[model samples]
Every structure is written in structure tokens, then in C-alpha cells.
Target: MKILKYIKTNVLIYFLIGMFLNSGLSLIKPLLLERLLVIQEDQLTLDMVLSFILYGFCLHLIFYSTMLLANFVSNNLQRHLQLRLKNQLFRKLFLEDAFIDDEKVSIVTQEMELLYDQFFLPLDLIIGKSFILFTTIVFILWQNLWLGLFFVAFSLLRPLPQWLMNSRLNNSGAAFSKNQKNFHLSVGDFFRGADTFYFYGVAREKMSMLEKYNEDYENARWRNEWTNNIVFFFNGPIEFFSQVLPLALGLVMQERGAELTTAGLIAMYIATMNINGPLQSIMYSVSDIQRSGVVRERIFSILEDSSVEYSYHTVDNVSELVLENVSKNIGERILFQNLSLNLSQPSKVLIKGASGTGKSTLLRIIAGKIRPDTGRLYVRTSKGEEFSQFQGNIAYISQHPFFTHGTIRDNLTFGQEFSDKQLLYYLDQVGLTGEIPSILDYHLINNGENISGGQRLRLELVRCLLREKDIVLADEITAALDRENAKRVRQLLSSLPIILVEVAHHIDSEMHYDQMINLKDYR
Candidate 1:
């Protein structure tokens, strides 16, 4: 698995050594107890007593110290695993743009957390406890062969309960995971539309919708817990019986005058408890690991998904964009058919269509966000090299702009270096310099929700200017602006020397355009 690659083998070796020493040292305590119990009261001197106390303290000190370091190592392993998984998920989400939605939000957040808690964390403990259990069994067998063999039989039988319910546990876990994702999706949608519901005085409907989702999530969670409890119920009695059987057999052997001392019998009882402890824990850990399979599959599916195979070619500058016999459809309904357009130089082109004629779809096709159903798009550079794909040299500005949570300067430069003076120049060109007093230092929250819609749109325009894109695909960018601000934006766009393909419902009367394409005619 890819997860194994993140496990630091050198560090893991240290962790394993710690587990071995810790488990081995734990068994030594029972042996020491046996020795102490065998001694009579008259022979126990002060020096012997002090030495026993010192040995006990030092042994525990080392045991706890080893345990602490092992825990730290496990934490480090978890950190490394989560970071790698999240990084891979982030890269895959953007690369596979067609496969994104609200469900992905749940995957990146909740599913990742589940993967750590149920899988990675439990797996570490299981390994350590398994080591301790093995050493305990070995000590028992060395002390008494029949008792050791009897304990091992019970040990093997203990996991049978969990194993029998394995399929049911997995099914309940899967149901819970599905319901969790659905509830998360519903919550996301409710919050996104919160303003609309509040303004329209329909907030009660939102609550009602959430109630249904909450019921499903809670029911699934209850079923999962109930299934796990059944395993626990069966496991409890078996653990008790396993412990009793070893002690009873030791007693029977003692009555028969087998070579067993009182200290040895006492040690046998302690060993039985130790055996039962690890066995019971291992059973639950196995069930936990089984339940985690659903989340593991969800994470691995995204991680192992093959990326779309396409190499993006770059041009220094775009000289022309030509579409021949282009067609697009949504399901069975054709949005546009046999559409053709040619732009051979830097110019403004207006695309106008009725509500369903695919104006925004055409912009997406030109922006390389999606592909047309038929025909080809050729992008030729100034040097006369024609490429069949539009991979670079363009900036797309949609109606709803995208902004990360950061300072205004961070949003504009997008981690690139640019002087404040240059940024202020563009901010002023978009009439935001006077509006934002902090200029570069102004912080934005929740994708600039503190700013007005017009300000967010202007910031997006500034981003395009800073990117120095050769072609700008504007999809109803001015729809949110007032008439005056809209006119200002239109004038600034018209003055630029780069090519602009704008899709708009209304065009200014005095604005100049080199060409216009109407999708209704093409249809």
C-alpha cells in the first residue's frame, strides 16, 4: 500500500525495540513477584527488601519511559501519514476538476479523520499489544506446558465472536459513512443558501430539511454502535471464561499433587489475566480495523485514481483562436450545433445567446475548462505554430470569483512577487484603492465575504491583470456592478490591448466590439 511508504523504517525500528523491551520487562515483574512470594517472612532482610523496591521502581521507570517514546513515535507516524494523504488529495482534486462536488468536502475532512482514528492509530496499538501478548504467552508456556497450551486454545477462540460478526460490522459501518456524507452535503447546501432562506422568511424549512438528514445520520450511527456492542457482549463472557479455565486447571493439577508451588499458581492467575487482557483488546482492534475498511477504501480510491492524460503545451502569446463546426450538448439536449468563430488578432468579441444557448459553455470551451462534443479548437501563436488545445495564455473570470482566505495582497499576487505600487496601480484602475485603506495588508475572511460583491469582482479583474494573460474570457463579470461601475469596468476592458471574449446578457450602447457571435443563429 502507498501508506507503507510513509512509515519511517528507521524510526519504526526504534519503536519496535521499545515494544519488545517493554513487553519483555512486563513479564519479568510476574517472575519477580513469584520469587518474592516464595521467600518466608524471617529470611526477608532490610537489604533484600530495599533491593526489591529499587528494582521494581527502576523497571517501571524504564517501562514507562519506553512507552512514552513509543507513543511519540506513533504520533509522528500519524502526522507523516496524514500530511502525505492530504497533500495527495489536494493535488488530485484540482487535477480532476470534473470529479469535484460537496461530497469531496466530507472526504477531505471527516473521512481523513476517520482514517487516522480508526486505522492508523488503532493499528499502532494493535502491533504493540500483540507483542506484549506474545511475550506473556511465552512466559506461561515456559512456566507450565499444559496451562500454556490451554490458554492458547482459549486465546484462539476469543476472536471467533468478532470474526463471525465481521460482515455485519462492515455493513453497518458502510451505512454510517454514507449517512455521514449525506448529512454533510445537506449541511453545506443549507449554509450556502442560509441568506436566501433568512431573507425570504423560510428559515423553518431549512430546519425541517436538516432534521431529516440528522435522523438518517443518527440512525446509522446507532445501528453501528449496536452492532459493536453485540460483539462486546459476546466477548465479555468469553474473556471471563478464558481467565477462569486457566486458574481452574492449575488448581486441579495442584490437587493432583503436580509439581506446582503456591507462587507458581499465583503467577499462573496473573498470567491468565494478562492473556485475557491482550486477547480481548486484540479482538476489539480487529473489529475496529474491519469497520475502518469503508473509510480506507474512500481515501484510497481518490489517491489511486489515474489522472487525465494530457500534456499542456504553452505559447509565448496567442495570435488567434479558431473553432470549426463546434457542437455541445447537455445529455440529450443540444445546447449549440455547428458553431464556428475565428479571431486572428487582439480584439473584443461579444457572444450573445438566449437563456439556454450555451454562452457560458462556449466560454468554458475556449477557456479549456471543458471540451466540445464535436469539432476542434486551434490556438496559433504569433510565431505561427498552431496547437490543437487551449492550455495556456488565457484568463477566465466567472460571475462568482474565487478567493482564498488571506490578505488582499495574497489574493492579488497569488504567492507571486509583485511590488505594492504595481498592485495599488491596478487596484486604483479597478476603483478599489480608495475603498480599501489597508491596500495590501487588508485581510479577507471566507473568500472576501467582508467585501462587497462589486469589490470581489474588481479584485478578480485585478488578478487577471497581474497574471498578464494574453486572452481574457469574461463570463458576465459586470452583472453584479451598478451601471456606473459596470461602465467603468467595460471601458477599462475595452482599452486593454489583449484579446477579450465576453459573454453578456446586455451590452453597452457605446461600447466598441470588433465582432459579435449569436448562438441562436448557429442553432
Candidate 2:
């Protein structure tokens, strides 16, 4: 059903045309071979042989054309579904407030790939192959009832083993997926905090953790392989019998003096060969699809979240942000309780607290990056209507600013189109242009590796200010800046009308704030 929604009518029309044509062409070889066999007995007139060859050549042309069209349709459909599923999953992650393991995202991407191969890859083939197999059997039955029964019986046997081992396959697949996710997470964490791991001398500990995941993944893989081997065991003999049994039966029928032309026997052999391939595909595809259950579950776990629905909300105004009776906890220890803040007007609020006191967490909650255990957050308009979100009016600048691999202008404007003059104005406000003359068009490596720490902060500040948001949440943004640059940033914040919530340990005595909350005492 989802596939149909994205498939274009022109593409679908081509797909259908190709499918019927493929099925029609499957009988061509058998028919031509049957005729050629008859002509050989008479030493065949030139006219008869050429006519037969011409017919086969014409059918081959149509066969290749239909095959090309079918491939084009299926390839496009696969790409469309891949992108659609990816966007839905990406949107879910972008909106999720609660913790979702990074490794799980890695697993989700892998699952999408496997799902495409197991499910979508063979989707159109199911229709085309089933039709071809059904018609082949009907044609065989028209010639001889016993031959049709033989083909059907063996085809049924091939899938029986897959059914027997399906439960084991599902269990193994799920276990492998879990272990693989853990393995990826471990490797990712090691690289992300390689310096800490080295300083702590916990390389052995991380290796031990990784080994556990590796062992579990290998064990699950072996179990899945065992289950597959069981399936192959049954399919092997069925495949052999599909080809060999027909010839054995034909010889017996001929000895028993059955009435049939030599051409009919040759057609039967060609049909037997043609029918078995499609039958084998249909049978094994059933098990392959079943094995991808873990993949489907992992991908949908992100795509089917109810929380994503409420992430985007309407607000009448962005002037005020309210947090009522907010509480947060980490495990047993309460970070904060019954915390209430009402910012009716724009102000520079400094959150002061010792390390690990949840100051950053509190700011994240305000930014809607994390949800408090208990609280009601609302944005009130001048007309008195409340909305859950403040839209794009709240800009979040983290300790380490995020920068994609693109030009400075690309990062600053993002999706919002800005004139070069307007971009330069914001750049000037953030003191970015003064440091680097050609700031806007300047390209950065991945995550702005080409720029210094202060430059990164300034570029991010400019990026946010370009939107002219009503509020800014800066979490230790000036921690990396020198006194001169930090003083410059503090003065720049004073000039802006936006509400600023900054969590910084280093503040000059001259820096003024509308409110300062020492979180250690904010009950």
C-alpha cells in the first residue's frame, strides 16, 4: 500500500506492461524449441526454419525491452521508498526529547538496507513470478495432469523447511540486531571520547565490553546460519528433482507408448526448466522476508513514535517563556524540584551552579531538548493564548557549536534565504567578520575543523542571530574564548533585545545580568 502511494502512474503502467510481457515471453523459447525439434525430423525446409528463427528473434526483442522497463521501474520504486523511510526516521530523531542511543540509529540505518533487500527488492517479482509459475502449471496440466501434480508437489516441499525453522530464525535475527547495535555504540563511544579513555587507562575495559558484544553477535549469526542450512537442505533435493524427475517421467511415458509429438516432449523440458526457477524464487523469498522481521521492528520503532506528533506546535507570540513547577531527576538523586520561572520580559539570566548540578540540563529543558519529570511549559502571547512551542524564536548555542561541511553562508542562513548584506550585518554583530575578512563565503571542513574554537562560537552565534530569535540559550559558549573575546561577546549580548539564558562559570564583575540563579540554592 505504501509502495503504491509513491509509485507514479506512468511507472506503474510500465511495470504492468513489463510483467505481462515477461510472462508471455517465458513460453516463447519452449514453443520455438518444440517447433525446431519437429522441423529437424524432416531435415526441414529453409522456409520453415527461417520462419521459426524469425519468430523467436522477434519475441527476444520484446523480451529484452520489457526486462529493461521492469528493472527501471523497480529501481526507482526502491530508491523512493528508501528516501521516504529515511526522512520519516530522521524527523523522529530530530524531534525526540528523551534519550535514544546513538547505536540504535546506526542499527536503524542498517535495518533499512536489509529491509529493502528482503522486502522491496522482490516485491514486484512476487507478482510477476507468481503469474508466470501459475500459467506454466496450467499449460503443463493442459498437456498432462500427472506432470502438473509432480511440479506442484515438489514446489510445496521446498518451503516446508523454512516454515519449520522460522521461529529459530526470528530469535537469532533479533539477538544479532541487538548485539550489533551495542557493538557499534561501543566503537562510536571509544572514538568520541578517545582522550578520556586514554587518560583513564580504561582501554582494556572498553575492549572487554566490545568483546562481549562481538561474541554475542557471532553466536547469533551461527544460530541463524544453522536455521538457513536446514532450509537449504530441503530446497536442495527439491531443486534436483525439479529438473531430473521430468526427464525420467518422460522416458517412462514414451516406453509405455504414450501418444505425443517429439516437439511436445521438447516443450515439456523447456517449460520444466523455466517453471522451476520462478517457483524456487517464490518459495525462498517467503523465508527471506520473514527473516527481516527484526529490521522492520527497529526501523518502525523510530517511525511510529507518538511523541513526534506534538514536537511542532503553534505559538501566538515569542515574548515570554514559562516553566511551572518543573522537576527533574537522574536515577535516585533529584536534580531540581518544584522549580518555577516566569520570564514576562526579555532579560539576561545567568544560571550559576557547581559542576554536575544540572544547570545545563535545566537550560536544555528550557530549549525543549529534554523534558522535565514534572512541569508545564508554555509560551504565552499578548492576546492570552498559550502554545507548547515557541517555534523558531528560541536559538540554542551549545558548548561545542555544530557545523556541517559547507560554506559559512550555508551554515548561517541554513534554509532561510538571507541577502549577502544582511548576512554580513549579523556577522559583524557577532565579531566574526572582524577576525576573518572573507567570512560568509569561507568554506569549513567537517564540523568547521578549519576554524578555531572562538571562530566556531562566533559563527554559530551569527547563525542564530541571523534568524533574529526572541531568546538565546548559550551553555558555556564563552568557555573557550579569551577575556577580550568573552568581554566582546558579553557587550554584544547587552545590545541585543533577545532574552539570554547563559550558564557560565567565568563572568567579569562588570557584566550585568537581569537575574542570577545559583542552582545550588534553587529548591
Q: Largest TM-score belongs to which candidate? A: 1
RMSD of 1: 2.9
Clashing pairs in 1: none
Predicted structure with the largest lDDT when compared to the true one: 1
lDDT string, candidate 2, 1-523, tens digits: 6456546677677666667666755777787776677676556687886898788888788777776766776677667667877776776766554535574466446667777777677666787787677767676666667765675566556666667777876777677666666666777887787788889999888878878877877887787767777777777777777666866776778778877555676677678777877866875676566666776665666566656633644454566778898899999988888888777656888888888889999988887777889988877777777877764567888879988788898888786889999999877876777787677779888798888998899888887777777778989988888878888887887788777888877565877988888777755
Candidate 1 wrongly placed segments (more than 4 Å)? 5-22, 25-28, 95-101, 199-201, 308-314, 322-325, 338-342, 384-392
* lDDT string, candidate 1, 1-523, tens digits: 5677656687667777766766754565686788789778989899888988887787778778877877777677678778887877876775456555665666788888888787887787788788888888888888888877886677657777778888999999888878887788888889999989999998898889899999999999899889989987887778766777777888899899999887887776677677767777777777677777878887787788776433455677788888899999999988899888888667899998778789999998887768899999888887888887656677888789978899999998988899999999999998999988887899999978889999999999998888777789998988899888888899998888788999988776867999988888877
Separately for all candidates shown, the number of backbone clashes (residues 3 or more apart, or on different chains) is 0, 0
TM-score per candidate, in order? 0.89, 0.87
Clashes of 1: 0
Worst 10-residue lDDT window for candidate 1 reads 305-314
